[model samples]
Target: MALLLTANVAGRTNGRNVARLLQNQFPAGPRAFRVPGVDSLNHARGQPVSWLVTRTASISGQELFNNYGLKPNSELILGYGFSLPHNPDDTIVLKVGGIEGRWEIGRDAQGADGLWKVILSKFVEASDATYEDILDASGMLQEMLESLIEKLPEEDIAGNIEVRADVVEMFHHYLEGMSNLVAEKPPEARSQVKMPFFALW
Candidate 1:
């Protein structure tokens, strides 16, 4: 199954600036490339950025900005298209800023399009610590697991009472561990907490 991951980043950067940043930061490969900057990359690397973009020569950076209402210091939506094996156990990991999260690859509620979509939100940057520290924090991990279980269908919960209870207990321990870790950190080294949204289509 092919998945289209879209990350909408909004800060003090414009679309063109963001496009340039992606062109440099992202790997030089077939599956990843910037929009307007893609033209040059395709010319130099002999790789096609997108079929639609190739077919339509009129598509340009300015056109994308105008179409999406992207302006100076506005939110820029970047997309990455990739393929994955069609399996229920498969999961997709999303990393933004300094935060990372994951979601199982599955069909949506309607399931009409026959495509798998996994959406992960609440991504934020960590200043004083690594992404693993924030993502693996006891409270954060518990919240992530609870959110995943809550999304499960009620019919799927019939035989998982014990397993769910176990997870709850694990969450409690994680919270305790995280609290200790935080207490050990100096007050000046602590970072403010902020959550950003990330979505996949």
Candidate 2:
């Protein structure tokens, strides 16, 4: 099992705190590094079951939990080693509570997955891919707003339309903010990596 908490955030002290919260029990062992462009990371690839703990800012965090079908508030966990490349645009898959879902976390123009899986995973628990088969998180978010407007009662319809327009404007602002976060590099801070949980399967 592994935790992809966020991008550009690995082996932080907070990560250690979060790891302790995992529900699955595993043996204590020395922690190791498996970051991209590192030897440990390469060796772990395709090896039977290793754990990864990642931390991203809010946007990235939402994407991981939502897409994987994990509870929005539940700690994020996924099986280690992937059949698909870990590119920004690739659809990462997960099975949560025995239901499978896909999550894409970057912008459409930026060619990354959206974070709708966060809401979808929570709103629809007995999951089906059809819930997320189309519309990545970004698109789904927009559609959700439109759907909300459509469902408004006749008396409230006019006010809802005005609010929806504001939502669209605000969404663009959030997108811009996320773009900046993705582009910036981490500060020169010393972050520690903790031991990863091991599984034989």
Best by the lDDT measure: 2
List RMSD in Å for every model shown: 20.5, 21.8
lDDT string, candidate 1, 1-201, tens digits: 111122345753244554454456544732323244422221111222332223223323523211222111101111211111221122222232344443212222122111111111233333344545543442443454345445433323355356555444434433333232222221211232234411100
Model 2 misses residue 200 by how many Å? 46
CA shift of 115, model 2, Å: 1.3
TM of each candidate vs. truth: 0.17, 0.15
Per-residue C-alpha lDDT of model 2 across residues 1-201, encoded as one tens digit per residue: 344332244654444544555433334642333334322242222223223443322332332222332211111112422222222232212222333554323322222222333544444542463424322332444444344345433422344345554444434433343343233211210011111211100
The lDDT per prediction is 0.30, 0.32
Candidate 1: Cα lDDT at 166: 44
Summing lDDT over every window of 10 consecutive residues in candidate 2, give the lowest-scoring window.
185-194
Off by over 4 Å in 1: 1-89, 92-136, 156-201
Off by over 4 Å in 2: 1-114, 129-140, 143-201
